[model samples]
Target: MDTPQNTALMRALAEVPGPLPTSGVVHISLPHTERFTVVGNHLAQNAALSTTAVGFAVRIQSLPQGTEVGIKALAARFPEGEKLIAAALRELEAHGYLHRTRVRLPNGRMVTRTVFCNHPEALLRPRPADASKRGPALVAAPVSTQAPAPVTAPVSAQAPALVAAPVAPHVPAPASVPAHVPAPAPVTPHAPLPAPEALETPAPPPVTDRPVPAGPLPPAPPAPRLVPPPTAPKAPPRPLPQPRELTPGLQQTAVALLSDLRRHAPELVLSEADIERLAPATATWLERDAHPDTIRQALTTDLPQPVKYPAKFVRHRLTVLLPPPLPGTEELAPARPRTVVIPLQTCEGCERAFRSRTPSLCRDCRTACEQPAA
Candidate 1:
């Protein structure tokens, strides 16, 4: 009979399904039976037991609502079947993949229910495999792990022992060597030769036709004489002052005053009003303080006399005026009209008004006709 431990081991082996072959393994593109098995197994080991009545669960919280399979169907496909299914459900509950809620049954009794939960990580992880058994390949086992050999000693320590020692000198027999030999005397260097006596040298020959010595340079030409410049001529003395004649107007006034005095000796005094009226309009011209009588007389007498004039009538011309615009005239000026020149042409077909300069109809008609021909 098989031992209980051996049977249990066999059961464990059976429970542990072999990893999918590399070629046979299906990529977990979407959730299916194979993917569900792997996920369910992982969740069963990770989740708490009491969360779900089942021992294991494939917490597919990210799975959309109204999915086809239930816990029973998912568990049936896995190796451990119902046991793994219970575990998977518990794992899914623990990981928050599925939520548990209390609901009233049709019979009026309240019961705990399981539903898929929403989580970003659970949705992104590999999905359960389909019934086709397609998923990614399983990981391979590790290779051997043997220990390495010990390291040996360095060459420096062993070099001295491997080397040989030096040998002593050997002496030959007398019969093989020379009989009587004189000992060599000590060597000494000879004295150096005596130096020659010093001799007197003759003086150099005199140079011919060389210029005579400059004879003290003739006393340096009596450094140039520094004569003083000629003095400037003195200016002539100025002339003495001379008297000047008076202006005619002043002379006339003086004569009139003297005549008045002579004619009326007893009443020589003039009225203040008459004297003020006779005064010149410009006071600067008669100002004795600024210009003395003598300087004034000299200036007035030297100046050219003024000409006397009599008043007379003269004619003046009038300037001409331009005429004003007439009433009801137009406000804006008319614009100039533009002139355009048209080129003359001879058409290949009609040859009437068409001009050949631009080849308008000939080129266009040819292009249009060529398309149909092509």
Candidate 2:
């Protein structure tokens, strides 16, 4: 090499073995293929990624894809987790080691997909190849057309000018006559042969109506009667829903609130759709955005001495004593229509209700469709 520096460096690099730690993560229990890259040589040590972040990254790697590893869950699980994890992720993303792509899930949810890299070159994503620019297809060259030159014969003294052989002139073939053709039978009028006598076919023996020994028919299953399914007895209709009969949709919302409470406070088991007994109180709680558990607590916390009929009593309390709405709730309420009417604008894509007046996809699906991939 011309340059001494290059020569020396090449020699030094040649002496040094490629990379360190040939073995992969020895822990066999790691879920999925996470162990393959967890401690691989590809994980370059970035100073920005502190010990905490590195720990967090390892934890993240071990987690299954699409798991709910939110900041809140991390904080609850580890000390100083939220801040450390956030900073670490931001640092890794800056170095192109981490990627967050908002992908539309098969279930129609818009979610961020986390793509982690052990070693990222930070290059732009490759684009699809251009069809027009493709190289020509492989094809064998055309076979040689001219016949081989005539082979030379041995010459006597001086070589003679080569004489060519003459080819015979082409002859046309004569038209062919039909094969095995019989000559016309001389147009003779011959006498007809005598008709043969008809053979007699004996008439089939007449089928006699014979008596059959019939046993009694099998006792057919009482021709299966279509008995309607037995339904659970419906509770008496709740007092005609008063003047303000809650719509089916609103009742569903109330029931959902009850279900949420059941998650945290399993003892609060009640049908979400038992709207007659639960709607007014549940609606009051939902309007304020009060956590279901908190609302349940408020209803059950300071009960009067030995309360009878817990469901009836709880319902009464929730309706009568609802906490004040959260401060910013007024702003949120404007987005909801004051008087519920069927949505005017339907989504052009899914034809779902609550599309803006101009007729577009609802917010979630709209974001999913319009979001530019990263």
> Model 1: residues >4 Å from true position, as ranges?
1-64, 67-73, 77-79, 106-111, 118-374
Q: Which ten residues in a row are the worst by lDDT in model 1?
A: 310-319
What global local distance difference test value does model 2 have?
A: 0.57
Give lDDT tens digits, candidate 1, residues 1-374.
96557776555555555564567533324347643434454444533445443333333433445643355755554445665466655555555555656799999999666565333244444433431354454544332243322223233554447323233257664664355775556533243322212122333443435576867533333323222222335665332211133456644553344234313332333344433332221122222222333322322232222311100000000001111223342545566699776687665665545545475556566677789989
Error of 1 at 142 (Å): 61
Query: What tens-digit string does per-residue lDDT give for candidate 2 at 1-374?
Result: 66457776556555655463467632223256534544644353656566766766767776777766566777887787566777877666665556776899899999777776654542333333432355555444333343434333333454325434334367775576467965446432244322222222344543435544498644433332222222346665333122144556655776666666545544455653454567765665665666666766776576665554556665666756667767775777657557855557877767777825466677777688777762
Among these predictions, the greatest lDDT belongs to 2
Candidate 1 similarity to native, TM-score: 0.17
The global C-alpha lDDT for each of the candidates, from Candidate 1 onward, is: 0.40, 0.57
